[model samples]
Each structure stands twice: as C-alpha cells, then as structure tokens.
Target chain A: MTVAAEKQPAVDRDVCIEVSNVTLRFGGVTSLADAGLSLRRGEVLAVIGPNGAGKTSLFNCLTGVYRPQEGNVLYRSRGGREVSLLDRKPHQICRLGVARTFQNIRLFAALTAFENVKIGAEIRQRTGPIGAMLGMPWVRRAERVSDEHAHDLLAFVGVQHRSNIIASALAYGEQRRLEIARALATDPEVLLLDEPAAGTNPAEKRDLESLINRINKELGVTVLLIEHDMRLVMSVAMNVVVLNFGRVIASGTPAEVQGDPAVVEAYLGTPADGGDGDAAPR
Target chain B: MTTLSAVARRARWWNHARVRRIGAYVFAGIVVALVTGPGGSEGHYSNGLRHGLLAPRVIPFIVGGLVVWAAVELGGRQLYRVRPLVTTVVSGSQRRWQSPVVRLVSYGLLLVVAIVYPMHISEFWRVVAANEIAIYVLLAIGLNVVIGFAGLLDLGYIAFFAIGAYATAYFTGRLPIHAPFTLNPFLVIPLAIGLALISGVILGFPTLRLRGDYLAIVTLGFGEIVYEFAKNQQGITTGSAGVFNIPHFSIHLLDINYDWGLPSLPYYYVSLGFIVVVMFLFSRLENSRVGRAWTAIREDEVAAAATGVATLKYKLMAFAIGASTSGLAGVLFASKVGSITPDAFTLQYSILVLVLVIFGGMGSIAGVALGAAVLTWLPELLRTHVNPQNRFIYFGMLIIIMMIFRPQGLLPSRRRAREIRFAEAGLEGADALGPTPGSGLTS
Candidate 1:
C-alpha cells in the first residue's frame, strides 16, 4: 500500500509523457503495479534495473504496444499539445513521433538494409496511391528525398557500407546499429533504445556511447534508454531512475542516486556496509 | 621462378580462366551452330539408324531458335555493360509497359503475316490462336494476383477454372429450377464469379497458416479433389460424359447469335477488349497501397504486420480476386464452347497458367501479358505445321532451357530482378567457398 501511494506523481506541465498509477496484471501475476514515470523534452533519462524490473513493459505502455487498464499515458506532441498514446494505434503513435527499438531485433529480414530503413520512412511518404500508380513527378521527388534521407541516417549510424545488403546478412553489431538508424528514420522527437549495449563488444559499446552522446548533444533529441550496463547508464545519462520490483527506488543525478540507501538495497537485495559500492561503480 | 612452381602457378590461373572461357565459348558455339546449320537453308536430315530419333522439320527450328536466342543474350549482356545506367533505366521503366505493347504489336504483325504469306493456313489455326490468347490473358491476370502481388505459390489455380465452367454448366444445362431453367450466359458470368469467390475463401481459410511448399501441396490436393468429384458425380455433372448444348452468349436486341454467324474475328476483338480492361485494372492495383502492402507482406510477413498491415486479410483478398478472374475466364470459355466438361479444367491448365506467369515475369503485369501472348502463339505456331507428339516435347524443352538460361522470365520485372539479385548476393560468396575445411562434405 505504501509502495502504491509513493509511485503516482501529480502531473506537471513540463512532463512530455506521464505514466500515472499504472498496474499491469496478467491472470494471477502483476508485472507492474502502481508504476509511474515522466519524460521531458531535451532530456536523456536512463531507466536501470535487473531482469524483471518491468522496464520493457513500461516502454511498451508508453509506445501504445500495450494499454494499461489502470492508468493513463499522456504524450505531449511536437506541437506543444498533449494526447493519450494508449488511445492510438501503434503506427499512429509512431506517426506522432515516438519511436523505439527492440531488445531482441525485429527487423525486416528479407528486405535490404536500405529497405528496412525505408519502411520506417513510410509515414513520411507524400505520395498517395494515385501518385504511385501514375509515377507522378511529385511522388518521384519524394521517393528521391526519402532514399537520400535513409542513406544519410544509415551513414550517421555507420552502417552505410551495408546499405544494399540484406538486413539478415549483416553482422550482429551492424544489425543493432541498423535498427537504431531505422528508429531514427521515423523522425521521432523522442527515441527509446532498449539495451543498446547488450550483445555489443567493448569497441562497439564505446562507439555506441559516443553515438548516444552525439544524438543527445547535437541533435537535441530526447533519449530514454533502458540499459542493463551500469557504466553506460551512469556515464551518458543526465538523470537516472532506479527501479526494483516495478517501483522506482530512487531518482536523481548519477551522484545522488549512487548514495541512496534504498538504491543499494534494491541492487544488492539486502543492505550491508556500503564499502563495496566502489567494487561496482554506481 | 623454378620450372615446377611456375608451372603450378600457371595451372592455377588457367583453371580459373579456363572454366569461364569454356562456359562462354560453349554458349557461343551453340548459337553459331544453330544459325549456320541446315535450319538457315531449310535442309532436312535423315537417320536410318533410328526412325523415331529425329524429325527433319523440328531439328531446324530448334537449332535456329537456339542460335537466335544465344546471340540476343550475348548482345544484351554486352549492351548492358556498355551503357549500364541507360540500360538500367530503360529496362526498368520500359519493361513494365513492354508486354502489353509487344502483345498489341505482335497481333498486328500476325495479321500482316496472315495476309502476306503465300501459303494459306487452315481456319482451325486462327480459332486456336484467338482462343489461346484470350484464355492465357485471363489466366495470367488471375495468377498475377497470387504470385505477382501476394507472392503466394499456387500450383493448383485451375480448380477455380473448373469451378467456373461447372457453375456455368449446372445453371444452363440440367438444373431443374423454375420452368425449364435456362440462365442467360451473361448472368452465368456473375454466378460463376460468386461461386469461385466462395470456393476461394473455403480453400484459403484452411491454408492461410501454410506457407511455401506446404501451401502449394494443399492447393494441389484441392484441385485433385475437385477433379475427382467432377469425374464421379454422374447425377449432377453428368460424370465423364459431361453436359452438352450449354448455349452460347447471344443478344437478341443486337441480333447476334450462333446463327447470326459472326466470324471468329469479332470474338477475337471482344477478347482483346477484355484483356485491355484487365491490364488497366491490374496496373492500377499494382501501384496502389494494397499492392505495396502485398509486396511488403511478401518481403516479410512479420514486419508487414508489425507496421499495421493486416497480412492475412490482404492475402485472402488476393486469393479471392485471383479466383474471380479465373472464374470470369471460365464463363467466357463455357459460353464460347456451348458445352462444359471436366476435362477442360485439369492440372495441365494450372501448370500452363503458372508457366505463363513465370515466363512473363512474376510480378510484372505487362510481363504476364507478354508471357501469355508468346506461350499462346508458340503452341499454335507448332501445331500448324509440326507433329503433335513432338509439340509437347518442344514445349517441355523450351521451358527447361528458359529456366536454365533466363530464370527471371522473358521480360523480368525490375523490382523482382532486384530482389533476386539481393538474394543471390547473400548466398553467392558463402556458397562458392564450398563448405568449411572440417565440414562433412569436404571431408
């Protein structure tokens, strides 16, 4: 009951996405209970927790992949207007500029790397069915633009060399990068990356860190990343939210969260002397 | 370099170059032989050792055709390399329209040939060509939906053709409904389409979950079941004896009838008109959102669905639409023939439709039309002068040779060729290395 009351925060004007008092129940099990979070524009927020911390479920709820029965998910659009993402279809939500990547890749395997990126640009196509039928000049122009933009995005992610290759044929790291590029191609104001460093080698992870930093600093794009790698979350994120058993244990800058007693208990499961905190950098 | 090492290095270089050169030369030699051989002069060869082993007339055509085919292919390759961008753009954009235009022009050419040629041909040849073109155009359009748009391999599409024919027969033949029960042939068209749609849904529902070869097998079974039912059902279908005097289409107001006695030319024009309309509709559908969804589903079903495409619904729509086209063709056939028999719709018809779709280009509407025209004309050309036993052998050989040489069909769609290239690129480098050193095959 204490956990339930502590989770729901009153809505604020700056909050772009507000998940309030959400509870996800599947039969007899509750995956997330009274879980709440708020995302804002031009902020890189990191959500860190162990396996069943309900991070992905929270992401699913925010993106309209699943509609939580108990609470509301309000997304503020690019026009400084707010709408409930739960009321819209996944594709409609995507059109409203919320894009995400999967922890396990879900690319179009049979399509070329370029085509996979192009599908993300489907919502941006200006041509109607009639234009495509007639091969109208306007449609052709739009197609050229889309292809150029797709190529540029792939290059930004350093996978442009594999543009014509089928997506399934790419190396694992390249595929991961391609997925991110695809998400970016949707031209979303906010990007959600799930485990960007999960299977990446050290060299690739370093590159991913720089990429995330560039996306935040130069592009001014809001990034909400759920990463299990603590070093990545601590180093790159401006703010960190720690979760345990679907409830936020602590929320602050990396330094403040590092000192929280509850955060320690959540990570180690039981509290001991805090000396070993340096053993694994907070 | 030492003599032995230098010799070994030369041998390695020779092996690589030799294989390629041999392939090229062999290809060229076949072409040259076909062009210069007796076919050019219309000479005949007689072999007393075995009477059935050779046919004088056939040998010339086959050899000459091969030579012409090879020279064109070699020329095309050289042209492609010399002006890559021009060829790519021309081939890409023009390929889509080539089939329909080619078909229109070829029909005109045939008309000219018919008039100018010194020798007089039989009336049956004209009938055969007209019927073949009409039926094939319909079949190609039907198949264009399943294979071209939806990318579903349907090996037994002829079942719908049989369904259409049977529906026409049952309605106009012996159905004891009302007083004397004679449905207008025009009315039977819609009825046939409706029946085919119903059958399409029935067939599609169970096999919706199936993909690739499994789906093909289930469809083949469905066709066989339909065939067997027609064969055994004597009370309704009249069994193997079939129904007779089904009645041809007539317009009393226009004063047209079997006795009004229009020549086959009028029927040919009508068929041509229908083919044009179908081509227009197919072209529109191919470039629409529905077509893109079909291509997306074909490319990746899971990704398509994830992008908010209703994959199952679109696929079923494809099947139903395709079956309806076949049904429409069947109605025409039944009305033209004035009778219906199960023999008219067989596995061979299904394969023939598939061959037409493939020979044109799977996803290209114009290619399908061209394919229909060529295949239709080829048989007629053979039957006019060649032996019946050898006609099929020639046809089979032609298909085999085409598959080996030009798997993409005569006028391969640019989009489909790109897809094939992408697939080949993925497989080529890995397969050529010939399994790892420790692999079972190498060991």
Candidate 2:
C-alpha cells in the first residue's frame, strides 16, 4: 500500500472536491467551524472523530443538505469544469456526480431490493415522464438497460441473491451493501459513505473493507467516508482527518494521523463517557 | 405499612368465592342496564320507567343481554386457550395470498366484469348511474396518484375538477365573461386538460416544499379558495347560478354529423372510453422510472434527493398528472349536465373521491375502480329502499368496520398490504416490513 502511495506523483493526482474554510451553524450552535478538506481522485479518504465531532456535518455540507455560511464547496466535473456546489439542491449535487448514503439506513422500505438500485439510476435516465407514460420503445429500452445495470451493481456489491427481497427484510449487513449498490447505480464520480461499517459484526466489517477497496481501486471512484471504526479507517483509507468538537485536529496519512498526539487525546481522553464504543481506546 | 395491609385485605376479599360470584352477577346486571339504556333500540319509544319490566321490548333486551354476556365469557376462555393456534392459522393464510397468481386471476376477473357491466344494465341505469360511476372512478384514480403513489396528501383535488369544468364553460362560450369563439366540447377537452394542468403546477410548485399535514392544510385551503372564487365571481361564473346550456359533445366531419344527445348512451360510452385510457396510462406510469421516483420520495424525501431523484419535480409531475384525470372527468360531467355549477365542485366531492381511493387500496388501479363503482352504486341502491337519514348512518358504520378489519384495502396493492401487516405486527417504522412482490419496472 505504501509502495503504491510513494510511486504516484503528487502533482499528477487531481483533486475531485475542495472544501475551503466551510462554516456551518444551526442557530447559536456551530456544527462545523471553518473546516476544510480536499478529496483526491480515485483515493479512499476517511474522516474520523469522537461523538459530536463534525464528521457527519462535513458530509452533510458537502452533499448540500446544509449550506455552509462561509466559504465554498467546489467540484471538478469529469469534463474538467470547476463547478461551485453552493446554493445547489441535493439532487443537483447528485446529478453533478456526487452520491451519499445516510448514517441510518434509509432504503425504500416498501420497494424490492432490485427496485431500490434502479431508483439510483433515475438521475441519468434520459426518458421523460411523457415517454414513460406513453410506454414508448425507447423508454422500454432505457428501462431494460437500467434493470441490467442495477443487477450488475447488486452483484458488484455482493447482494444479488437478495435482489427479489424487500429492502427492509434484508439482514442489517445486506442492507448496508444494498445501499452502496444503490449509490453506485447513480454512476457517481465521488461516493460518500456515512458510517458504512456501523452496526456490523467483525465478519461483515471485513467484507465491507474489501468492498470499499474494490470500489476505490477497480472502479476508480473517489470515496470520502465518516467512520468511527478505526480498523476500517486505518486499513482502507490512504488519507485520514481527525476532528474534535467542530474543527479539524489533525490531517495526514492514516499512519501519520494515528501517531499524532491530538488524535490520541481526542480518542483516549474519556473512553468511558465521550467516545463511541468502536472509537474508544482498545 | 398501612397501605400494604389494605392491599393484602383487598386481595383476600377478591379471592373469596361468594364475593367473586356476586361480582359476576353485578357485572351481568350492569350489562342489562346498558342494553336498555337511552341509546338502545327501544329506548326511543319509551319515556323513562313507564314501560313495565315485563314489557315486550324490556324483556327481550334483558334476556338477550344476559345470553350475550354469558357467550362472550365462555368464548373468551376458549379463545384465550387456543390463541397461539389461531394466530398461526391467520398468518399462514395471509402468506398464502401473497402468491402472484391468485392476485393476477382476481384482477383479470374484475376487469372482465367491468367491461361487461354497462351492457347488462338497464338503459336508464347505464346512461345515468353507470356513467356517473365511471366519471368518479376516473377522479379517484387521479387522486390516488397524488395521495397513494406520491404520498402527497392532497385535500383540494376538486380544484382541478372546477378548473376543468370552467375551462369547458369558457371555451364553449357558456360563461358570461368572454369567449373568443365557441369550440366543440370534444375539441375543447385538450384546453380543459391544459388549464387543469397549469392550476396543478401553480398549486404544487409553492406548496410541495411543505410535507404531510401542512401540505394537506394548504390544499384544503386551496379547494375552499377555488369554490369561493366560483361562487363569488358573478361577472364571470354567474355566481351560484353557474354557466348553462354548455353545448353537447359533438362532431361534424366528412358530411357526417354525430351528437352526444339526450339518450345518455353516447356520454356513457365516452366516459368509459376515457376511463379505459386513463387507467392504461396510469398503470404504465406506475411501473416506470417516474413511479419509482415517486415511491422513493414518499418513503424518505431526503434519501430520495440524495440518491438523485428530483423530489419536487416528481411531486409536481404527480400533481399535474393526477389533475389531468379529474379534468377529463369534469369535462364529461359538464357535457352530461349541459351546465356547470360551483355547487357541483364542492369540498364534499374532493372528500368523496378521497374516500373512494382509501376504500379501494390507494396504490392499486383495480382497487380504486372497484371502490368508486361500489361506493357509487351502493348509495343509489340504498336511496329507494332505505330511509334517507339512516342511509348515511349505515354508510358511516360500514366504513368504520372496513377500516377496523382491512386498513390496507379490500384489494390491497402488494406493498401496502405488507406495510399494514408490519404495522399490525408492532413494528415501529413502515420500513421494517419484509420484501414485497410486484415492485418491478414493468407492469
């Protein structure tokens, strides 16, 4: 892993998203205070912190759920256009090649697993409502393509066997993988996972780790995740950022951040009360 | 310590056989009194205690109450003993109906019945009664798209109906305000649809941002506003008197003239044709990308948005499409009546259509059609035989009983049935239900 990192020229690696001094507040309480980070193309980056750290808030701001009061979130489109992501809607961000999953699984509970993945491809569907209402051949062909693509994504995420099952009926680990498959169906250039390994056993976590690695390496999609699982963050992420309260405490390679004193203090200060079970000192 | 000793004494008293036996007799006596209370059947005929204990009504009620109480006590004991077996059998039967073939055959048989219905009926009933049922079915299906599929609880769906009716009035030169030229009612159908579509967008664009009950309140206000506008705009709508003598739906082509005149036959066929077309289009929309997007938004708007489903756009689309169906029905209504009135497009009409949708399964096309037909026909059937005051009471009781037993619907859409079952099973969120069949992209 270190050898590949050393071989890649720093100047050649493109930055996909740049968060510059972004500040977000909910009334008097500040959730993110002048926080900034950059996600490089085709790399796995993890944002790790204790409870109440602005990790999930940073993800929300990037996805346009909450607008930052100051600074900008800028994205480099595949066509090499610099697009400002501020004032844009969440779906607009998704259309511009950003996809995200919720911290708590938010699958379409009444829809089948196959249908859940198909909804992700809706952003890229060219057929309009009129064409669909008319049941035109072109619309049918597009639907067929979407169906096949959804199945492929399900298989890619290793949940194809549960395709016919309702999303809510799936095992917890399967729901997590299905959510990832649904996100992938959007053809996103950058994927954000909010606590993707949460509530999973050791075996499921190992499966998730390899899946994230495959998504990053084989598919060449950029990933930015908010995770409390240190094993996942240390093993999978090439870059890690540590947050405490509402600010970034340290940012570097996973090994470098792990060795930082601020990171240690954030995690080890009150393991019994403040730290999440997974993030506590082991 | 005194409170504890008091509780112990109460427990000992409750355990005594004579006290238990006396308690049962008192319970039976209270039930007897309740049975002959003021709200009872024969209470209306009697003043107070003037009727003797041996009076015909008094004796029957007293005896019947005791018998019912004893049966209930005996049955409760037996049912409690076999409740586990009963619960398993009920769940097992519910699972059996989940099979797709049973649903498919039932739907097919229903379709065949609907197609042959107008043919077997009398001319008067077919032209007047059946035509009305067909028109209401169209409205119910339209509202179902918004409330059922899109999960937008629209309470002002009748506003679209009013717009459609008024559009026909204006285009046919029936309104007092202004008319560029009179157009054939058939030709003006598209204009009426367009007007309703614009109104839907106007209502949806601003209010779609609000969710659940807030949206419902706004739509309710919107319906009232439309009604008031039609009732008060004397210069245009003629106020309560309404526009009159709207031309019959007709056509003159290739030296042949066809008029949907007073026989009501042509109007019946016309409404049926529209119903068939709308149902086909709706089912197609339900099984497509648009339908999936609507379902996603309904379940979780934030997740749907994050997944690239444009939430507002789909909501508005559902609103407009739902409005279009009501517009068509309104046009048919106008042509049939040869007049349009503000009274016809009341809030009651909106609520009636909503009831039909809920009575039938919301998301199921066949279910709404059945609901509309049954609701429309049942009232008409009761009108001649039953007392007018009692008819509404009976209808209310029936609806309450329906909701208690089958909250999902008579013929539930697969997803809705599972959702209701999950809720019944003490699940916290609707999202906890297992996999439902028939959520594919194809119909």
Candidate 3:
C-alpha cells in the first residue's frame, strides 16, 4: 500500500504549478496562511473548503491576480523552464501557460462567446496593430488559426451552437462552460477553475465532471479546482486538499480525506465554536 | 460618532418632490439668465454681474425653465408610452441598414451629397466647411479611437492636436526656433504625426492606469501644460504672437508644380481625401484583433489580462494611434490656415471634440463624422440666420432633449448599441441591429 502511494506521482512527469508557503492577507484578515499545494502534470487536484476558506485566494496567488506577501509560485513552462510566477503580472503569467476562470463568471459580457474565446486564442498571435490594419496575409492566417481554434474550443465545451450569442446572454450553465472554453483558448498547460460547478444543475455538474476528466486525460492538461460538490469532487479529483480558516487541514486521495477527522472537524465545526453540522460553501 | 450620527439623521425635504422638481426648473432659468444676460460691461456694476436678477432678461430665463418643466412633466408620460414603439422602429430600421447592399448605397449617397453640397454653398460657408468643420470632424474621429475603441477618457486630446500643429510649424521653419532645414507642409505630415504619437505614449505611461475621471483630469492637465507652453514660451512658439507665414499644402511633383493658394476649395478636397483614407483605415482597425483586445479590455480588465492580453500595451497603442490622427489633422490645419495661435488649441476645442464623439455615437466612425458635420454646420447656419451669441443655449437644450429621448446619438454603431442596451437591460443583451451569427471578426 505504501509503495503504491509513493509511486502514484509518476517519476517521468513534473509538477506543473507548485505553490509553497503562500501567505495572503487583506488588512487585518489573513486570507491564506502558510497554505500550499502542488498540481502534478496531467492530473486533477481539488481544493475543498468552506466559505471564505481562502481557496479563491490560493487561485489568485497562482494566477498573479493576487501577489502573496510571502512565498513563491513556480510554474514549469512547456519549454521546461522552472519560472517563478510571484512577481509577474496576470497577462505575463498567462503567457507562461497558466490560465484561470473566476468563481463568478467573468466572461467579456459585451463580446460574443466566439469573440471571447478568440481573445484567448489570439494571444499567441504576433500580429501588431499596423499589420491588422493593413490586413496582411500573415495576419489573416494568424486570425484564421485563432478562428479555427475558437471553433474547436466552443465545440469541445459544447457551446458551438451558441457561439454567436453574446456572452452575457448565455444561460448560466452555458456561461460556465463558455468560460472554460475561453480559458482553454489560452492553451494553458495548467488550468485553474474556481468553483466551476457552483450554481450548475446536477446534470450540468455531471457534464462538468466529464468535461474536466476529458480536459485532463485527452488534452494532457493539469487542472486545479476549488469545489464544494462532494460527489463531483470524489468522482473526478485524484487528490483533495481541505482548507479551513486559510489553513490546509488535510490532504490525500479523495476517499482518504473524506474520512479524515481534521477535515470533518473543520467542515462540521469544532467544540470551541458552536458546531454547525454542515458548514457548506455556497 | 455622535456628531456624525446627528448630521446623518437631519434629513431635510423642504417641499414635496414634485414642487422641488419644478423649483429645480426655475433655478435653471435664473442661472441661464445670469449667464446669457447683457453684462456689466454695459451695465452699472463694475465687475459685470449683468444685473439680470432685476429685469426682463431674468424673466426670459425663468420662462425657459418653466417651459422645460412643462416638457418634462407633460411630455414625460407620452415619452414613456412611445419609448418601446420608438425602440422597436429604430431597431428594425437599424437592422435593415446593416445589410451590405444598404450600407453601400447609403455610403454612396452620403459621398455624393458631400461632394455636391460644397459646390453650391456660398464662399464663406465653403471656407467654414473646409477649415472649421473638417478640422473638428477629423479631431472627433481621432478622439473616438481613445474614448470609444480603447475605453480611455482623454480630455486633453487637443494637446496632441496642438503638438501636431507645432511640429508642422517647426518643420516649416515658422516657429521662433527654426528647423535645420525647411520642409513642405505636405512632407511634414508624417513627421508631425510621429511626434504626437510619441507624446501620447509619454503621457499614457503614467496616467493610463488612473482610470476614468482621474485619467481625464491628468490629460486635461497635459493639454493645459502644452497650451501654456505655446502661449508663454516666447523663445519657442513666439509667445501667442503666433506662428504665421506657414505655407499651404502644395504639389511639387515631377510634372505638376502648383501651390495650393488662397481658395478654400483645394483645401476642402485635400482634407476630404484625408478623412476618407482615415475612415477606411480606422474601420479596418476597428474590425481587427487589436480592436477585439480593446473591447475585451473595456469589458473586463482582469479577465482580459488573465486571457493573455497585454491590456496596458493595447491601451497605450490606442492612445498613440488616436494621437497620431490628431497630429495629422493639426498638420493639415496649420498648413491650410497658414498660421496658428495658442488660442486656437484651447481646452474648449478638447471639450468640443468630446462633444462631437458623444453626439455622433461613440464607437461608430460614420456617426462621429456625421455628428461633426451637422454640429459644425448648424453653428454656421445659426450665425447667418439667428443670434449667434446665444448659440450655446440652443446647444445645451438640444443635448438635454437628446439625452432624455435617444441617448444613443443620431447614429450609433451596431455593437455599441448592444453595449448600451445590455447595460440598461441588466446584461440581457437584446441585440440591436439583429444578430450576426458566428462571431470573432463578424462584428
């Protein structure tokens, strides 16, 4: 059993994103305290926590949206450079092959879903304003590539039929899927999804679970997700980290952490505070 | 805390809401009366208060205010009732107008009218069209790039215009500090544009991150700084004595060597050519990936950044491009007018250009150009037939009515209309001008 557990992380693959000793604070509130997690290449890792447990904060830190006061986020680029993500801006971090979706949908509301996804796909394009203005053939080729990629991504996320719809006009579930499609457009080696299944119906949740599995298995992309849906998490996640009050309380295989006493105590509340039996993150 | 709480509790409503609303109209009347009334230059008071508070002038303002109130109160219900119908008809027509055949025909008609109308106008009106209207229209198109495409509020756009003018002057050896070698004003256009583009980047580096109001204030300051430099720097810009004898645009080609002399017709044709070229190029830019990045940045900066768009770089590019256009207009203006003063590039021109963009419909290139034409032409018409002194009062009223009725200008871009409608409808995005499926570059 010990040998199998030790060999679970394949020796050939490296960590895609490694967060270590990260601490984030907002004024007097310490949002994440000495919290850390590592996402191995081509695997699904879930960070499960109650409301305000700093799961989103951790995501922000990794994506360069929130610069932690201490600690480092190291990303291994496809070029094999172990680059530090701590000091870079969000766009620079994205270029280094890490993309993320927001907990609340942050799709470009005014743009069409196809345009929104194209925005991501076109990041790899080298066309300048002058080139675009002149309608150069090379620029056209770049645009066509991005357009084709946008089509494929929209299809992959099952929103190809609604690709022309304005992003804000999309149904909530479709918006969620569209957002995933947009993040994928950046062609990231690692995709960070913050509560992708938060408001989704059971059927949509099931769909998301399969999509996530496909993203990991077929596309060979690492995924780090923060979720509250135990069924979806257990079904898809290979590893789970439980956080409470900005601290990582337990981490292991989904089934192992499900039965851990510390994770249970954190979720159900402790004796010092009046215990809420099910402290769900909404 | 106790004092703050006490102050907060002192909620005062002196009259019923309706009475106060009417009274607000009355107050506007008094203010307009004081401003537009015959001044103390002709009156008894030394400081020129107008003494409108005591006379018939005050009565007119008060009457105007009451008229406004009547329109709001009486016309309010009718407006509310007709709004949906109006929106339906407007949107329906807007959709028809988007077809390729309709668009081509409309553009052709507009071009025909533009070319023919100038020939029939009086010489004075022709000069106004060539000089004032064309200049303002060019300035408006440049500003639309900043405020509409990039979503950056630039109140100091005229600063870039002034820079272009000064560059032309310097290049033509008209400034107090002469150029190393004189260049034809035609040849100086690119050089002046480059100068303005560079200045735009310099200004944007520190101020673009300020966002909205703060960004506006910073640009306003920059405009004032340039204006002051031109006005007071005797060694450089001749200290408001102005730069003169700046030669007009000419063609000194291999076979044709002709100076574009005093007649404004030549200037009009050349300026029209510039406008057409700019419109074509800008439309292409607006439909490109660069334009998409700008729209993305405007919609959600964080999302744009995380999606690998260099948001700041795209913003700077927009600012610089807009500035370059302003520079081009300045070069043309300087050469055609054969002179320029600091007074010509004041803060007033900046606000006027902004008004043109907003009145034209922010993002629509055709709309902005049309807006400039109409607004500038109306002033000339008023100067000829009506009292020009009170022209702004008419303008203020027109704007107020427009804002209350069709906030989307006389002509609006199809995409910009969607943006405004979505905002008003809480992001439902009931698309105006109908939907064009399979997006990306479709817009």
DockQ of every candidate = 0.16, 0.53, 0.47
TM-score, predicted candidate 2 vs. hidden true structure:
0.85
TM-score of 1: 0.65
TM-score of 3: 0.85
Runs of candidate 1 with Cα error greater than 4 angstroms are: A1-7, A11-276, A279-282, B1-122, B174-181, B254-263, B384-387, B427-443
lDDT of 1 by residue, B1-443 (tens): 59999788768854665344545655554544432333211133333212322434344445555555556565667766778788878878667645878757775785566344313445575466456677778878888889877888887799898888788877775532222566877778888989998899889987866766777889888888888888777866777787677666656655554431234544555556667667767777675555766776676554454444555677887888889888888877776666677787778888889989988888887778888888888876876455544466567878888878877777776556655665566732121112211121100
* TM-score for chain A as predicted in candidate 3: 0.93
Q: Residue B126 error for model 2, in Å?
A: 3.3
Question: Which residue ranges in model 3 land beyond 4 Å of their true spot?
Answer: A1-5, A8-13, A272-282, B1-92, B427-443
Clashing pairs in 2: A166-B435
Per-candidate iRMSD? 9.7, 6.8, 6.7
Task: Show pairs that collide, candidate 1.
Answer: none
What shift in Å separates residue A11 of candidate 1 from its native position after superposition? Answer: 7.2
Query: What lDDT does candidate 3 reach at residue A65?
Result: 78
Local accuracy of candidate 2 as per-residue lDDT tens digits, B1-443: 99998778878966765455545655555545533443313434443234434346565555655666555565667867798899899888768756878756765776677667767777767765545787898899999899878888888999898888888888888888778888999988998898888899999999988777778889999999999999999998999998889889888999989988877666777787788788878888899999999888777777888899888999999999999888878888887878877998888989989989989887888788888888887777766655544467557766887989888776777876766676777542353112222212111
Pick out the ten consecutive residues of candidate 2 chain A with the lowest summed lDDT: A273-282
Each prediction's whole-model lDDT (CA)? 0.72, 0.82, 0.85
What's model 1's lDDT at A56?
Answer: 84
